[model samples]
Target: MLKKLEAQPHPDDANPLLRLTNLDVTFTTSTGTVTAVREANLTIYPGQTVAIVGESGSGKSTTAAAIIGLLPGTGKVTSGSIEFDGADITHLSPKEWVAIRGSGIGMVPQDPMTNLNPVWRIGTQVKEALKANNVVPKSEIGQRVADVLEEAGLPDAERRAKQYPHEFSGGMRQRALIGIGMAANPKLLIADEPTSALDVTVQRRILDHLQVLTEEKGTAVLFITHDLGLAAERAEQLVVMHRGRVVESGPALEILQHPQHPYTKRLVSAAPSLASQRIEVAHEKGIAVTDEELTGSGAGSVSTSEIIRVENLVKEFDVRGAKGEAKILRAVDDVSFGVRSGTTLALVGESGSGKSTVANMVLNLIDPTSGKVFFKGEDLSTLNSKDLFKMRRKLQVVFQNPYGSLDPMYSIFRVVEEPLRVHNIGSKKERVNKVVDLLDRVALPRSVMRRYPNELSGGQRQRVAIARALALDPEVVVLDEAVSALDVLVQNQILLLLNDLQADLGLTYLFITHDLAVVRLIADDVVVMEKGKIVEAAPSDQLFDDPQKEYTRELIDAVPGRKIQLAL
Candidate 1:
């Protein structure tokens, strides 16, 4: 029998900072009214950090939206009360909400691309937060913006502030959002998946800053995330929501260590940190396994042959300096790696570490400054335009952002069949059959084919992207941060789907991501990159068990909930 642990007591238990009592939120759509949250109850004392964890569409974000008074598209609190700092705030006027924002409560939303204004400069946006809150005088807004950006972990803050949202990477834009949210030093901060887009090292830095705010300023935080490992590591209280209801709530470590609810148990089991080491090593301990043993292939295996090879690859770009002078930026510097014909090789690194640049060089999407990429012993650069066009059929890529990659105007059927039509491989009827088969392989229903990309969820859209990538039967596929944005269950499904496809079709993968926990599950070998250079390379198990480089150790250490021991 599992033991039922009691909730941990807090010093400020007598005076709650934020409390949601029997809350119910609903959204009235064209069809009907749908309850997004039901009877949800939770409490956070002064300086307390509470995390709400669930799969996508489990009402975690809805609850946060209700608290912040930003419920979208006819969403409203139909019942219950939201008390903040001992005052009822369930229904505030527009002017009242404006006053409450920034100074009273700040928000860091999930999607940086949508939340940050594209037309405004990064520094100008940060200054708006300061000015709106009246935290500083107009004369001091410039320096305050720089300070906030630097504190949020962006280097060369002044220069970065001048750049637009398009100029910043996904991680940098997320950091800017964090800086804007924390600029006013509000009493309550709502961070909705704040660090989901960041690398582990930078994520640690951002969370550490939040910790400082909680400790020194007594700032309460309502954290919303899909990553249970991260929630356990950072939050004091944990609330589990499933199907628009709170399934479990209690102390963070205790609930995760010995979960009672079935949904919570499933989340605990699906977490990459707890379920690492999915790949089987079919050999004696400490003995290296053969290629055949690693991939479970027989005599027909292509593991011995190198399908893709990058030699001394270098890529450079021209950019403007802080002083408006032209400067050369070496994105990938003398990096080299090889992908075996029937294996998975993951490139793990932080943003701006040149992983994607290397992938681009291998895919022939961009020309390298120097060095060579060989496919089946043929140099890519030497190929003519016609040859390059034909080679694309043999090499395919699935980008990070599926919503951006997939055409919103095209139906799912057309999106998957586009590759076949472009390659002139089959007739219309034959292409339709191929699209259906591909969707089946990815575990998506045939009904989705009639719908468009906008109709599907994040996971469904990614599945559609994979189906398209596999339409041409490519021997090598480059998955660039493919599963980074998905929730755990969806990410696990995609990884398993990739593994099954690789086994069935003898596919090779060049997987690029910053997530080491997922790497442990799917990657056969690992290449660690730092600032456009390869710092370490080894088999997955060897690297995880005994990492040689200091940077590698730091990255592994940064994986949340790795050190926590959970009960079976």
Candidate 2:
């Protein structure tokens, strides 16, 4: 159980630990200078947690970068006064910034893969932070690294510290970054979407640890995220940014319950909790839900026929232990499930719970150690090579990271048209027309065909990926954390688009995700996994309304801001 900390004094009643006054940040490009943050002001008192909430390009992150003195590429603070702990730090020398970085103000960035060095061991990187900050003597640094990792919720810390970044899952890497950020015992911590990549249970654990830090050490936190629910639950003060300016700032609950700005109103309505409410209301009324509902709850009745079925699925991997001894790790053990035609089955679990592994087995991307996967009443393992090749055309997948999944070198047209070309599905001119139609269906402009994936936003890139997946006209489309990385607005757009596509195309979806709120909105059925086994399975409405297992209830409870009373 998480221990509740004593109430903190309101921000207005206390001296500010960090303050930003009339801040204006700009970036100079080849075209001209563009302001990223304009006349923004914020405050954080000691032991107070303040959140900056906004969309993807709303300048929340830019404000955070300015605070840390690490604004990227041609960006500068043109006008602002930044005061930290009674000291003016608007403009500091490189040496001065270095001296204050870890010891005074630490940061936990959003993407762990990019923030962490790929070639270095995790332990070495943590050690470097301690050494750079001079937090401890060299002799004690090794033990400190283990302690930090363990505190961040990584089990077997000594063994995990020796692993590289690639060896850790997304949640594990994020935890390691948190440990590094808190290692120096800084007076202030800046967490940028810190728990976005984590599962609800793990997110609760990490946030609980941070709350303990605030209670014991009086460390102030400047939390930055696109999640309003998280902002409402974790912060005492909320600063809402839109189009490079602060549109609203006040007590977290007050702003959330009675949002003043139009943008803030949109954010509150688009949040997953409210979206789920819309779904419930629609079902209760027996009314057809429109795309505007953003709940994806109108995908027609599920067929009795099973499009995909798995029985006694087992997957195992051989790995070396801390003592260098070989052992077998069963990733998926006796997992069994079925997806009916024209319906969405959500495979939900925390990282390393074997959900993705099960998806891989279903797709035949990897061979299972035992058991069978049947598609259309045919066993997959028994198919010949030629038959397997033919079957692959009916199965498609959209990976989690749009930036990684979409090739950088390929134009949008080629990326969508490649599947058609590989299967010899159509002529050159026909494929061109098909690609254009697919792009339109996913809500991208026809002109986007000429642009590359790197030029588009995360949401646009995902639309392109969906276009590619549909290019094959597959029977089952596996979405592996497809909308997990996007902001709330973009996520709602993508979910609505998916629902429209599924209804129109009669697509069978195997949606794999760790977010139960999203599952509540998009999934028709839910399968809960933990430690490679199924703990519960039920219809979406039943599971969320009356969860049978403790684990399932824990996940539902862990959803941020579920208990908050919103005006919507």
Top candidate, metric lDDT: 2
Check candidate 1 and list the clashing pairs.
none
lDDT (Cα, 0-100) at 327 in candidate 2: 75
| Candidate 1 per-residue C-alpha lDDT over 287-327 given as tens digits, one digit per residue, 9 for 90 to 100 | 44444223222213336689999999999888755333447
Clashing pairs in 2: none
Q: Report every candidate's CA lDDT.
A: 0.85, 0.88
Candidate 1 lowest-lDDT run of ten: 292-301
lDDT of 2 by residue, 33-123 (tens): 9999999999888878889999989999999999989999999999988999889899999999999898899899988999999999999
